[model samples]
Target: MALAGALLTGALAGCGDGPVRMGAAAVVGDDRISTAKLDQAVLDCQRQFKNDQVANQVRAALESQRQQQPMSGEPADCSPRSALDTMVNFEVAEAAAKTAGVSVTEGQVDQMIGLMGRQAPAESIVVALGMPKEYTRDVARMNAAQSLILQKLGADGNQQSPASLQARQQALSLFRQAAGKLDIRINPRFGSFDENRMTVSPVTTRLSATESGVR
Candidate 1:
């Protein structure tokens, strides 16, 4: 699905540290984005290169240095663990919306797509979270789900009422449950997390080849 960062894609924003080797270290929830998985994905990008070259290229390309302003109490990276973290958050939120039987219309999706186009004139606006063109529909669904949750929460008046709190608690519990099921391990070469540190806002931006029409 179109994750938050995906939505913020192309906005010049930015992930992790571990072993000085190839692959995904751990999976956030049930999803395992292991080193081999990460390597294969990278290799897919530059098929002309050998496996060693592909691994090195990915190492060079992935975010290595911390750039974002540290949040008051957050880590430099969001540090969710694996790609599954995004999906876990999305699914939890989506499940909440589904429980309420919320529905969205095609017209609304079109409007959002239109708004993104207006917000980004130079960059193409095909999806909500900067996902691939093929995922536009999914992005619209995610946006709608977000809107539904916000609307209900706002209508509740107590905002932090028992039900609202329970919903949030349930979501977190599900995420933690999935995470516990995985065979996850963090490689020290990548970087260690500082539980006390926070990432600052106004994250650093990276130039996109798309803006330059390179590829």
Candidate 2:
């Protein structure tokens, strides 16, 4: 399914044909999310479950339904919204990494991928992220970059890097600090991703299997 969406993206670009086509901009404060970007997020999910035709069928359907629904009335953002938030978060992390003199080189990302082994970083990243290895290497790079940023921010004394509760807190603190004064407004479709008040709905009740229109 991910492969199909990827192949269809260029064909759908401005025509607004496929499920991956960019829809409308979900403007939040100064930030504006184009439908194309949102579509890409949806594709990411499809790519994750590419191994299971049944899962792909269900996910694609649910995505199609979501595309038609007006985001204005929905109060919760689901996983796709979470994906969007991650994008927003990545921007902040990139900026923070710059300030902290923390940079993730292609070599480093490659090293991380090597640690994960064979198929490629994109594939390894799916395992690392517990996500599907879809889209392209660029997506994998972004994921690796985000992971690097989190590791750097979350690192403690450096003796033995432990992904502990404190590390998560530190990473969040860095993220918030780096995000600084950016104003983000979530569309009603995507519920608030407040660290203190996160709300996730079961995918089954909110989405349908054939709604997204993916193969």
Candidate 3:
């Protein structure tokens, strides 16, 4: 998800100008990420979010504020569409790594997860981001793959360094190029891909403030 640059240079670089496979949330290369898979992931994430003490406290505070005065809009929360996006990103990143001949071992993934757990509870981070626990491995794989790609491109992992930033941009360009070749497709019900952002653009619906309060 950190990669930047156009994901597709043109329609020609996208999933073919043909109908997408039925019941598929997305297609990455030859693999289908079924709608069922996305639904299950979303359900898992929602359950974890509901059980997380921090998330519950935040929601309770939001509700308290809403009762005191008319809230402007609904509070932010994870959605199934967001889960679909996350899965798509994982698939794309994995495919890009494969294309680049980058490898990430299970041990590397576990190590990355351990490092993340130092900042905060890793499970809480995954749930807050609407990612299923099972996808944690994929998340670590993506991170490891990206880090390796950056190093291969001569980028030091220092965000504040101008040279590092430039090198990262160059690596991102390569990632995008590899992603473009995969012919990724997303179901229109979820949203379309934003070639410029190299990510899904979920469709937005604007509801009246009163209608929003009902939810």
Candidate 4:
């Protein structure tokens, strides 16, 4: 139900538009995602992984009994840049959901997390995907909003009726408009972002990057 580990990230080289912001990992519209904030998030994720190793195993075992697919394996690098990419994607998805008139309330996030808890402790799954423990609710809200928006557009279902196709197009147009209005900017220290694909890949660089707990 959650991103199912399908994070759109890689170490692949790509180009991002807009100017780099000082001390900011990214700038989405008026808000800034600070580099320090991103680093702290990555640290939190790594710490959660280490602290919840047993919980992670418990989650796997529960999911197996339920016959649910396991969460996607962690990305090879779990790169700090990739961790930032998750935040960016969540931001974009939230904006798009708002624009589409799809709302995911606190109660909805609670329900989603409740469902996830049945698979394993929500914190364990969240950290397994390299997200900060503090973001567990925020992540649940975004994923819930994502599914709601897609279901509304009939994009998540198998039906390909003309009406469904039209709805899909409408969803795409809405997301594109939302993204364009945001005018996202990324720091070269992280990587380039492809708006069309909603994917972030590292750019060519000579600068050194320090990844706490990843070394």
TM-score of model number 2: 0.49
- Looking at model 1, residue 13 earns an lDDT score of 14
Per-candidate Cα lDDT values, in order, are: 0.39, 0.47, 0.68, 0.70
- Candidate 3 lDDT trough over 10 residues, lowest sum: 1-10
Model 3, 83-161: lDDT tens digits are 7667767776777677767788888888888876685666666665667667777777777888777776677668768
lDDT of 2 at 195: 31
Off by over 4 Å in 3: 1-15, 54-77, 204-215
User: Of the pair 2 and 4, which is ahead by TM-score?
Assistant: 4
Of the pair 2 and 3, which is ahead by lDDT? 3
The ten-residue window of minimal lDDT in model 1 covers 192-201
Better of 1 and 2 by lDDT: 2
Q: Against the true structure, candidate 2 has what lDDT? A: 0.47
Quote the positional error of residue 155 for candidate 3 in Å. 1.6
Instruction: Please tell me which predicted candidate would have the highest lDDT against the true structure.
Output: 4
> Which residue segments of model 1 deviate by more than 4 Å?
1-69, 72-90, 121-130, 155-215
Tens-digit lDDT string for candidate 2 (73-190): 2322225655565455545556656665677777876766665545434453342232334533444455566566556666454535565556666666665655544444444344
Per-residue lDDT tens digits for candidate 4, residues 160-195, read 777667776777677667767777777766776776
Highest TM-score among the candidates is held by which one? 3
